[model samples]
Target: MFILADDMGFGDFGVFNGGQSSTPQLDDLSGISRLYSQHTSASPVCAPARAALLTGRYPQRTGVIDTLEARGTDRLALDEFTIADAFSRAGAVTGLVGKWHCGAIGEPYHPLKRGFDEFIGFRGGWQDYWDWTLERNRTPVQADGRYLTDVLGDEAVGFIRRHKHERFFLHVSFNAPHFPYQAPEELIGQHRRTGRTERVAVIYAMIAVMDRAIGRIRQAISDAGLDDDTLIVVTSDNGPELGGDGEESADRWNVGLRGAKQHVFEGGIRLPLVLSQPGVVAAGEDDTFIHLTDWYPSLLTHAGVTPVGSKVLDGRDISGSFTGGTVDDVPRCWQWSRYHPMPTSNAAIRDGRWKLVHPAAAGTLGLTDRDEWIDHDIKRHPENYAQPIDEESPGWPAVGTEPMLFDLAADPEEAHDLAAVHPDVRARLATALHAWYEDVELDRARLVST
Candidate 1:
């Protein structure tokens, strides 16, 4: 079982938030699960982050470098093999509930075609909470007055019950606290009474509802008599979205980490990861640096299933780390921008405690004209927009600036730059980071041409 939260910050968990938000179920789960202190999403944004999570490779290599689906940037290359493919091939029932942002345009990109036997969710970056249109194996189902989170939770419980006698993989992705913050009046009133602004109150209420739904899912698992046999993992796709302007503002505590959802800083990529199994994983904190990509190979290994193909995986099987084993420290890289990918903009590489970043240039993060209608038209009439596998690349202005270096061991906030103090380390990491950029872009280019 894998449970994912959308735009949930490090501090959103009550265990880390000092009681600002209500996440009692997650807080209790953390006590019995192995908490990773240095877990990070593979990307700072949703599409690419989920692409990396599903495939054991970087998002760039999978042809999902951005979030805009109308331009077809969010589609995962068909050649890539997902963890679900491995599990399904190994004879386990696989189901996905909630957000399926990896791809949203064509039937080829639907979750049903992507190794999932059952899928009940929206296939976009976001949806209206109160008025949602979900698909159960490509058949649309209109909303029925229940909150979206609760609906997804109920679907997850149903999947578990139906497959209780067989091996199954269930991914429950809750699009909570992401946007369009709508919650029950009771939850909103509780937070508002504590003096939170309308936006903050609504966002916290969304998270609170999600927390309760998660508790219900756990109870369902226990009732099915699969507690000892199941491995439950909870995490977020990326960090919180610190919203913009007036009532739209969603700024809140993020556990003193720097930056927000679209940034390359710790706060953008750093996320909470909890793994629980009765006797397999002991309850304790592990400071190992774990990336979202690791889950692909790790989960397959845990289930004793081999990968379906020989495609090279950028992630390693760290299942041993679940039981206090040491994992090798590997260099990880991240780069993201709107429309076409600009390798030098908002790129970072972390090798151990030292991280080198090329900050995003001013005026380089605006959405394209394609974004305006993509969200609305694509979901309703996807056949109208049969986007090419690789759309023509858009021109972007080059950004020129020296990279900044930070010793995260000392400055987790990333407030101070030590590039001048550590020129040699900066040069070495820069070479490696740029080399990674070239390699992944090369794969992306080949994917487009073929």
Candidate 2:
């Protein structure tokens, strides 16, 4: 069972740093599950991150670098091999019970056609919690006045109940705490009692409700007697969406990390991960760098199935790393250039403790100026929600022309830049990052041509 939270930050959980609201269920889960302290989402945005999570490859390679449009022709290519397909081929029941933002316009890119036997969720990037359209295996269904998060949890629990006797790969994705900040008034009042602002209180309330829903799902797994057989992994698609007015509260939830979502900073891409499988994997904390893309191969390996496709995977199986083992400390590159074929903005590469960041202006870098690609919530509530921009934000600095280098080991907040101090490390990492960009662009070009 894989549980994914939408737009949840590292510090949102008590296991990470204890935000204004308590997450007792997740805290207890961390006590029994392996806490990955150095895990990162594959992308800074939604659709791309999800694409990488499902395919075990970079979103750029899968042609899902941007969020899909409702009327546009952009979609995840049908040729990409998915983890659900791998498990289903291995004779296991597969289902996805949450946000399926990978693709939605056509049947070819639908979740049902992408290897999932069951899919019950919304297809767009954001949906209303109180009222929204839902589809069950590509068919529209009534929501029945239930909260979206709870609906997903109920569906996941039902799937587990029905398939408890067989091997199942259930992806219980919760599109919670993302936008509109809607939750029960009781939950909202609970956070408000903590002396938090209205915006922060609403966000925390949503998170708290989501945590409880996850706890219910966990209990369902335990009750089904499939805890030992299920390799459960919980993580988020991206970091938290910090509003413009709540910097202090953001620090409380983000643990003083620099930058927020939509940037390549640690706070944007870094995530909190918990992996548990009872007797198979031990419970402990690991700082090994794990990407969302790695879940594909890791889950397949844990399911005792060999990958049957000839797709070139950018992710490595890190199942051993959960059991007091180590993985290769190689350079990992992350890029974010929406609506552009070439990656030229907010690109970064991490090699050991040194990280090189290439930040560019909004209009420069040959990237498309997607000024209208604002979040729905932000558009509805501009004062309450804000994009992670440096001009309006205090801690977030403007991206300079010169690439910056930071020793994450010493400066996790990215307060200091060592680009000039350590030229050798900067040159090596920059060269590698540029080379990686070249490779990604070349691969994309070849795929486009063929």
Top lDDT prediction, candidate number: 1
Window of ten residues with lowest summed lDDT in model 2: 386-395
The sequence of per-residue lDDT tens digits that candidate 1 reaches over residues 1-450 is 999999898888889978888889999999999999899999999999999999989999999988877777889999998888889999999999999988887778889888999999988888878888998998889989989998998999899989999999999988997876799999888887444568988988999999999999999899999999999999999999895787667888898898989888898999989999988898899999999999999999999999888889998888999999999889999998877678778889999999999887665566656566556666666667776435455567876356999999999999999999999999999999999999999999999899
Tell how far residue 254 is off in model 2, in angstroms: 1.1
Best by TM-score: 1
Which window of 10 residues has the lowest lDDT sum in candidate 1? 386-395
Model 1, which residues run further than 4 Å from truth? 193-195, 380-383, 386-394
lDDT of 2 by residue, 1-450 (tens): 888998888878866664456799888888998888889888887888998988898888887766634322135667888898998888989999988877655567778888899989876676788776688986787658888888888888899899889888898888887876688788777877444667777778888878888888899989998778778788999888775665235334587788777778898899989998888788998998888888888878877888858988888999888787998766788887545533446888988899988775454323222434543433233334222322221122344346899999999999999999999998888889889888877766676787
What TM-score do all the candidates reach, one by one? Answer: 0.97, 0.90
> Can you list the residue pairs that collide in candidate 2?
none
Q: List the residue pairs that clash in candidate 1.
A: none
> So what's the TM-score on candidate 2?
0.90
